[model samples]
Structures are given as C-alpha cells and as structure tokens.
Target chain A: MTQQHKHIISMLVEDEPGVMTRISGLFARRGFNIDTITVGKTQTPKVSKIVITVKGDDRTVEQIEKQVNKLVDVFKTIEMKDDESVTRELCLVKVSLSNEKAKTDIMHYAQVYKAPIVDITPKSAIIQLVGKPQKNDAFLELMKPYGIKDISRTGTTAIQRGGNGEK
Target chain B: MKGSEAIVKTLIGSGVHTTFGFPGGAVIPLFDEFLRFEGKIKNILVRHEQGAAHAADGYARASGKPGICIATSGPGATNLVTGIMTAYMDSSPIIAFGGQVSMSLIGNDAFQEADMMGITLPITKHSFQIKKANDVVPTILKAFRISAEGRPGPVYIDLPKDCQVGEVTKEAPKKVDIPSFKPVYRGNINQIKKAADMILAAERPVVIAGGGTIIANAAKEVTVLMDTFMIPTATTIMGKGIIPEDHPLAIGQVGMHGRKAANYAVINADLVMAVGCRFSDRITGNTSSYAEKAKVIHIDIDAAEIGKNIEVDVPIVGDSKSVLSDLIVVMNEKLKKKTETEWSKRMKELNQLCRCNMDSKKEPIEPKKLLFELNRILKTDDIVVTGVGQHQMFATHFIDRMKPRTFITSGGAGTMGFGLPAAMGAKVAVPDTNVFDIDGDGSFLMNIQELATLKEENIKVIPVVFNNSYLGMVRQWLEIYYSKRYSQVKLGRHSDFVKIAEAFGLGGIRVEKPAKIQDALKESIRSKETMVLDVYVEPESNILPMLPPGGHLKEAFGGCMNAKGVFF
Candidate 1:
C-alpha cells in the first residue's frame, strides 16, 4: 500500500438482472472502498458500462482488478488514467437566495461556470452543472457563501479517450 | 417431475453416490423422493446435522470427489456452520443442502424458515437460494461445479419447500461457465524459469510442501523437485503425507511442534520453495523472522495467498502439479547437473537431530510410545483421523504416512469433535480400508454420541482415546504461556469410556500399562463391532518441539530436542 491515488476502472459487462449486484458485491467483499460508481446501458443492447473510482495504492488496485475480472458478467476491465480518459459528472444544486441582488449574484457565478439554472424561486434556485468533477467542485466553491439549499451529484464516470476499447 | 425428484435426478447426474443427513419436516418431501432412489444414492442418517457436515467433509477429503450433506431449515442449517467452516478452511469440496420453508412463507418466520444463504455466506465458497422450481436442477449442477472446481470448498444451496413440491418439465442442464471463476492451471513459463534459476543458485534450498500439494495430487511432482535437487523438504501439518516420512529428503512436520530439523533447515536456508502451502502463522511463527534469510518462490492455486502473509521473491499462481511439472522441465533443461552442495549433507544430519526416541516405558503409557506402536500397525495407506489436542500434535510428530489423504484432521479450524464423524465418513467412503480416530479424552467427548451412529450404521472405525484427564493441548499451552497455573483444563477421572462404548452397543478396551497397549489396540481393531481403545497416557507429559507463540523458527523447546525432556 504505497502511493495512494484515485483509480478509475471502466468495465464492459453483460447487462442483465442481478449483474450490477454481482459487480458491486464483489468490490464490497474485497473491502475496496469505492469513491464513486456509475452504471448505464452501453451502445451495444446487451452490454453495460460500469465505471468505478476508488482510492487505493497499487496493490489494492491490482487486487480489485483481479476480483472484478472474476465476476461472470464482466467481459473487460481496464484502469483509466486521468489523461487517457474523459470523465464527467453532473450536479444539481438548489441555492437559497433571499433578495433580487443575491439571486443575480448566484446566477452570475453559475453563468461563469456555464451551469444552467433549471429551476428558480424567490427563496431558492436549482442550478444544473455538467462537466468534469472538478468543474462541479469549482461551482460549489463559488456558491458556498450564497447560502446553498441542497445538492445531488452524479458520481464520476469515464470513457477512455478515442476509439480505443469501445467494445 | 416434482422439484424433489429433479434434485435427486440432478444429484445422480452429478455422480453424488452418497449423502449424510438427518430427516426433518421441511425435508420430508425430499427424503420421500430420496428413498425411491436409495440404491442409486445412499443417504446415511447421522446423529446430528453437524455430524452430517463433517462426515460429508471427511468423505470429500478421502474420496477425491464432492461430498453431499442435507439438513432441514433454521437450526439444522445453522448446525452445519462448524462442519462447513471446517471444510472451507481445509479446502474440501462439499455440497451442502438446507431445506427452506415455502417461498411464500420465507419472511413470515413460518415453521423452520431460515435465511440459509446469509448464515453460510462467509463460510462457503458460494451460497445459492433457488427461487423457482425450473432453476432447481441448474442450480444443483452449478453448486456441484462450484464446490469441486478450482480450489475446492463447500457450497451451500437452500431448497425452498415450494420448489420441492412442484411438477415441471425435465430438461438437460445448462453448461457451467462462470468465466470469472476460471482457475489458472498452467504455470507461467517465464515465472517457472525464474523460479528454477533461483532454486539452482541457492546453496541451501528447502521445499515446504503444503496441503495444496495433496489437493492437486502433486506429490509425484514434488518428489521430482526434491529428489532431483536433493533439497531437504518440510511439510505443513496438513501436508504430512506428501511423501513417506521415512524418505531421506523428507524433514517431517515444520513449524511449532514440527520437526526440529525442519525448523532449523528453513531458518538456515538460502532459498525456500513454498508449494501450495500458505505460509500460515502456525507454519511461520513471527513471519518476519521466518525464512528471512531465504529468497522465497511461492507457488499456489490461489492468487490472494501469494503475498497475503509473507512477501515472496517469485510468486507462481497455478495448480501445484502443473507448476511443479513446468518447474521440473525448466530445471532439467537448463541445469547441467544436480548441484550437490555441502549444505545437502548437513541437511541429512540436521534431519537426524530432530528424531526423538520414544522407547521410554514409564508408568502411564507415553502418547509418543502409543503413536510409535500405532505407526507400526498402520500400513502405507491406512487413514488416521485425530481430534484437535496434544494427541493431534503427537500424531503429527509420530504417525507415518506412505500415501496421501490417509491422514485426516481439522487442520485449518482445529475443530475438536472433527475426528469421530470424519473418520466415520472416511471409513464409509472407503469401506475396506481401516480408518482410526485418534482423539484425546477431552476432545472425544465433544461428539461421543457419534458412537451410536457408528454402531447402528455398522461403520468400523477404531477410536483410540488418549485419556489424559485434561484438555492436553490447553494444559500444554498453560504450562508454556501461563506459568503452569492450569485453569479449566482438567476433566476429572469420573467417566468410564469403555462402559460408555458398551452402552452404545460397541465393544471397547481399557489399557493402563505400556505392554497392554498393543493388546488393547489389536483387540479393538479385531472387534466385530465399532470399537474404542481408551489408552491412558501420563497427564503431565507435554508434546515437545513446540515453538512458543510469536517465537522464532529455531527457538522451539521441549522434548525431541533432547532425550530427557530437555529445553533449548
């Protein structure tokens, strides 16, 4: 356990009932503390893409890879480097703004981050942000002093850059 | 076909010739259907559910096939925990079934309903709860495959009452292809080549043969590695019979209470070849200091065990026999000659230093003497099962095995009552072979009721009870670790074991003197019914060559090191 760093593993799996449970159950059993995970149907009708981010050293990453590969539904698993992959996360934030000037300021910050205000009220506004995880982090940092009401985050999901490993 | 009928048919298809279990309400339907296929598959009724699990385990270990055991829901299922755990730890392939309540009444807490899968999850290699009758046969086939394939272990399946009460179409079972569970059988040639080079370079190379060797049937390959290199070999308790103990290169048991020569050789070795044996804490006490001087080449079927406990220089993950064969080929091709170093000659002498003289004819019969005499009667392939205690250690030190799978004991879990049922199961598996359960007085009583099972089943297993009047192993631990202030270790001399045997309708002999040991043993072995030989041993005598808890390899003290119970 040396050099702790976030590891992103993208997997291609057979999309079926209980397949998600098997994959997640495997990671859970290995004691691999998952930081984030996103699962959805892939372009192939029967296949699904599951991207999981975990913080661990090299050995833990290797162990997780071996264990995940052992799952029956998993067809392929590959470790994704930050530079080699395009990662994204979506966050919906509801901000509390009492006055018109506060609302204008919150909208100004949201616009700077290119986040769209999807819902609004005199007391609160819901700003939807989409980009890398860090972009959402920046938007939250900007909105903290504006009295934030609530937030829901879509965990970091990734796809390897270019046409490589698309199957 | 009814679900119960499908299960029986699937079991027959899977080559399950025997099953050990007890009948209960939840399993009544299955039992009724099971009786119809009686000659096709024999179900031995055990005294308790736990006994059934252990018997199944014992059968699996001895027969080299998956053993089956069935039990009712709730209590019956939970009872198999100890037995299933014992099998799990020892890598025995056993498929256990737990009858569940109807699928509708599962959560209603109806009569005899239990979450069998949840209880057995941690202990089993895998657990399944079948929901539909159509899935019963496929699930059964998968259970068999999972239990016997790769690194064998127990697999539990919960059969709901509803699934067993239905009529469904009979169809061919699907192929078992859990791709993720693929076991690596062939060794990586590059790694094998690297390991061969490491072995060739070392002056003092010691091969530690573990249970994996037996599990993979790799003794012939292990011997090839040992004999070709003249490398001194040591065996874990579980690996006792990898080769005949009398073989020149064999260094007997290694670890706490293991052979002194073996402990010395390992500590002094330049290179260690750990084959199929996990360097368990008991095998490698104070892991840091153990084999610290050696460059280790660890070979095993399990990838997780490679560097889990001890760091290895070269880790080869594959079946032991396959790896050993690949290693032997690589070594034979690369090496010009068998490198006979002076270290080889020293190993032979060191091996002799570990040998103990058990000729003492003291008042109370010595367990060592009993083991020595017993060894004489036990032929090459005779099976010996022992309950966990000082008797187990003594058996490890003295019981000689010329063949594999002949020595059975609860190695991983060290469950006390494993001996009787295990030996019973082993005898049942190989009916013609003489199976003996060498147990301590304290350990024997743990499952003494199994005597009735043996008597009624007509299973011939000689139970040699080492009546020391105390939990001998715990007492020894007290002596070494607690300044001999023995607490809760003694079992006072009140019970008569032979009389108990007679009550069970089995004959028994009580031997108090050393000369009568042979007479008692022969008489018990020749008895028409299941017999017990209560051989009284000196209570104070402790098993020697014990490495203290967290002690270094060469730091072992007690008997075997010197003639008069000398401590080093």
Candidate 2:
C-alpha cells in the first residue's frame, strides 16, 4: 500500500449557491476522508476561498485535487505545503474551576499559552485560543485534568507563507 | 415579455425545435407559454418525466444537438433523476428544466416543491435556480451553452412559479463566458509528435475508437489513420458504429461480451492508440492485465478521464478530431511507404477465424438470427437503439452500423427501458430515418407506457422485442457463476404483449418460429404506424464470447464452439 498523509488543499471558487456542496460532495462520493474544511469570502467580491484537509495517499490526493478542480464553480485548487504555509485553528474550551487553587493554576497555564479567558462564571471559565491546531491540541490536553466542561473548535484554515498571494 | 416567453424565445434562438416534457401544477404557467409558441416549438408530452429525460438524451445523441426536457416540481423532478444520470454518464448534451414552488414558499416546505438544485447537482454538469424573472433568459441561454460545450453533459435549470410569471426586461447575453470552464481542444504538439513516433516504431498497433469519436465527428479521420497505417481497429460499446463492422480493418466491438478478434488484437498489440475512449471497466476488464503488452496512448477531450481508469504511456488531452488530424499530418510527413504488413495479415486471419454461425434452422429463433435478418434489411442511414440486456449484446455482436451515431444505447449507465423512448426521441430528431428499438422482454416492459405516446404522436418506431420471458443475462450468470439456482429471474408467461399493443391502438405481432422473424421485421418497417414485434427467442440462450466480470479480456470464452465443447 502507498504511504498516506494528511493533505491540505486550498481552492478559489465562485461565490455561487451550492458550490460548497459541489466540492464537499465530490469527496464524499469518491470515499476520500476529509479531516477538516474551512470556507470564507475572499478579497474578490464574487469569489470564496476554501481550505480542505484530507487524508489520502499521494496518487489519490492528486486525483482528488484534479476532480475538485473540474467542478464548474471552482477557479483553481492548490496544495498548501506544511513548510511553506501558515495553518491555524481557533478553539474555545470551558473548564470547571472547582477551586481557587485550580483556577489560579489554569489561569497561569492560560497566560503561558497566551490563551485568554473570554468568559468566566463561578463554576467555569471559557478559554479562547487562536493558534496552530497542534498548539490548541496541546492546550486541550493540559485542560483534561481540570474537569473540562465543553470544547468547540474551528477546523484548520491555511494560507501560503510568502510575500506573494495565490491568484 | 414574461419570463416564460423569454425562455421560449431563448430555446428557439438556440436552435432547439423539439422538447420532451410532462406537465404538473408548478409548471402550469410555463406549459401555457409552450402552448402560445406551439408552432415555434414542438413539445412532446411523454407518459412519465423519466421518459422525457431519456427521450431528450436520445435526441441529443442522434441529432448532435442539446436536447431539452421539462418536468414539474417534487415527484416529477425527482423522476428525471435516473435519466439525467444516464445522460451524465454517457456525456450526452441535454438541458433539463424543472419547476419549483414560488420563491417565497421555497424553504417553507411548500407544496409540490423539492430541492432540485441539490438533487441534481452531483449528476449534472451545472444547475441553476432562477431566483428572479430577470435571471431567466440569461440562465436558459447559459444552460444551453454549458450543456453543449466542453465534453458535453446535462445541465439543469430550476424555475420557480414566480419566475415563470414575472416580467423580463434585460436583454439576453449574446455570448456566455465561463472563466472556470475552458476545455482544451488541441493536443500538445510535443505529445502529438511523441504519439506519431510511437505509431511509426510500433510493430503491431491497434486503435480503439470510442463515443468521443462520434461526439467529435472524427470517424473519417480515424478511418484515414487506419488505412494510412494499415492498423486493425476496435470500438467500445459506446463507440459502436464509428467504423463499419464489415470493414476489412475492423475487429468488431471490444470488451466484455465483445468479439474474439477485437479482444485478441488488443491483448497482443505492441501499440494501442485509444482515441476518445475513457477505458471504462466494460472495455478494459481486469485493468492490471489489460493491454499488458501495449504501450498505451490515450487521447480524450476530458483530461480527468485519461488517467482515471487505466495508465497511459502517451497522454494527449484534446478533442479527438483535432489531435488525430495533427497526428496524421505528422505521420504523413515522416512515412516513407504504406503497405500491408505481417501484423495486418495476422489481424485479417484472426478476424476470419472469429466468425460465428448466425443462421440456425431451429424452431425457436436465436437472437443472433433475428439481428442478422434486421442487419440485411437495415439501410445505412437507419438507426438502431437498444435497451441494456442480452439483446443489446446480441445487437452489438450482429448489427452492422456503417455510420457515426447510428447505434445508440445506454452504454455507461446501462439503463433498461431506454429503448422505447430513446427510439422515439431519435425518430423525432430524424423523421426520414428508420428508427428501430431492439429490446428484450425484460427491458421493453420497463417503459412500455410510451406506446401511447407513439400512437398519439405518430412516431413510426419499430420495437423488435426478443421476448424470452426471462431475464436471460442474469440467468446466464446464475448458470455459469452460481449453481444454476435461478432466483427471481423468470417473468412467467402472464402478459400478452399483442393485446397490450392493440390496447394502445398500435400494431403487434408475435414471432415464435425462425422463418417469421424476417417477415415480421419487414412488415413493421413497411407500416407507417408503430409496430411491436415480440420475438420468442431460445429461453436459456446466453450472449457469449463472455469475459466473466473482472476477468482478463484475452480470456473471453464461449463464442466459437465445436462438438468437443472447446473454444477456438
């Protein structure tokens, strides 16, 4: 079997209704595993940027990119290399305080991670962090022992790490 | 002008003179517009919306123009899904218009409303929902352009009730520009040169023409290449009729249930130039073993299809006619002489050795015999459309189609019930040509409801039904692959098709003996009205030279057999 890796594919697509489904449905129909997908309006008024992270072998990923590019609404598709691209995720975690000592420890750890407390209650505090997905994962691991109440995450979105922009 | 009127005008302006449709509540306003423009556009009302879609697909395949179909909302639109997918799989150019509830009631679970855009998005080349009246003309025009351009496929436009009734003010665009959807029409010069070099160096070369050849109208170019190079040629099922079956260089249809000579040539050839073919599994059985000895050159308009199924040594992405024309020019300049080589002699011997006995004096008629008789009487201009089944395979094996777009079948989707309506669509497109629907009992019954449409519309289509009263193909599979433990394969003698045909006020005949087959076909052809000839074939007969599903093409068995029960 060929070696498989998590691939990040970014695309510029027409801002048309059902364009997202057209893109995502292709992956589903082809049975490719999509790890995460993020979409937002681009600077161009009638276009949108979509970042999709999928797990597949090299050949399959190449095929997926070609198939995605074939969609009528898609303008272009490019692979965002890990070493040459900036990738980030936003994660919000609500941790149960339980005690003052625990709360101080959590706050200290939050400050070290540069994660700010966005909401606070007598029993819980919501820590909001925007960083690389691995960093957010590490923070979540540290909060596991504090009796975490809940967590929400925005899937990883990426851009090229250079002076030039993708057309 | 109203939005519906603008739509009618746009369709007429686009050179669409015929459309197939079934009306319902949501499309009442649009149907009224069709009424007002009755002379300008002839809308044939089909029994079912699915029939409408298939008929349009058939029209497109026959006429080489974009076919149009319409249906009401919800169930009506949903019924078109199968036919739309069929056209999509075959890459036929068709535009389907579906009605939707009023825009205000769209998301509120309005009566007779369905998410047509969502339902058909995956199956269509593109789909649009007319949000307002102003968008109607442009959307319809764009739909036609998109469906007919770039590899050609079905495009859908959903019309809401308000949009149909609303006023249109803006002028329709004279041309459509889609930035994201450009198709490459000329192959890379370097690649074309490489392909020419390969052809020159090849000791044995074979050409596999496909549906793309017909779409590109590259049959003449393919013929020139074959004659110039003295190469044997084979065609995929969709590619049938591109080359005359009786041409000395022709090796017949290639793939599962294909001719022995065709499969044998591909297996042994040193160079395989596949033009306008996607190498579907039906064509390239056991992909790992397919064309193992050949350095494959694949030329197609769709780049994605080139490498999707089979690996190619020389990949040329362009229109087949354009690419072949360039390749021919390069070859012509480089060639010193053209003569029949040892490879061509071997191919001729192989073709001669693969002939089967089509004349049997048995009581029950063999399906092959029926097709042989049909072939004798069929004019070069006559068209034969088939449903998917054993009869389709027999027709593929026996029928001799001498022109492009002469043999139409549901190749990719293999949709049964495609014959009747598709034949109707073809007859509509070419009234002067004789259109025959060669169907099986199992397949013909699937869309027998179209007999009424034939009677009312006066479309003269001869339905040559091979009525064995069994799903013969599946039964063959059961006998060979399974333990002959037939399960639900038999549709016992319950329905009388002659009575059924007469019920629709059409002519019908049942031919139980071999001698009556030719006369029945002749009678049907002579009649001005539609006639159904339900032929009783050998009950347990099977279509052979069969490659078991996923088996190597070279290993195809059971066409030529002696008393010893061994293949040649």
Among all windows of 10 consecutive residues in model 1 chain B, the one with the lowest summed lDDT is B559-568
Q: Taking the candidates in order, what DockQ does each have?
A: 0.31, 0.67
Q: Pick the candidate with the highest TM-score.
A: 2
Expressed as tens digits, the lDDT of each residue in A1-167 for candidate 2 is: 78989899999999998898998888888888889999999999999999999988887888898788778889999999999999999999999999998899999999999999999999999999999889999999999999999999888999998784888
Enumerate residue pairs that collide in model 1: A70-B180
Q: How close is candidate 1 to the true structure, as a TM-score?
A: 0.93
Clash pairs for candidate 2: none
Please provide, for model 2 over B22-64, each residue's C-alpha lDDT reduced to its tens digit, 9 standing for 90 to 100. 9999899988988888889989999999899999999999998
lDDT, candidate 1, B1-568, per-residue tens? 8999889988888887889998887888888987799789878889899899989988988887888999998898888889999998998999999999988898898987877766775577777788878889888888888788777899998988888997766675667556445677888989999999999888999999999899899989888777777888999988888887887779888898888778878988999999989888899999878898899999988877788678889999999999999888888888745866788887776676667677668879889989978977887778999999899999999888877799999998999999999998999888888899999998899889889999998999999999989899999889888999999998888357899999999888888889888777788778777889988899988888788878897788765644223213
Q: lDDT (0-100) at residue A45 of candidate 1?
A: 85
Q: How accurate is candidate 2 locally (lDDT)?
A: 0.90
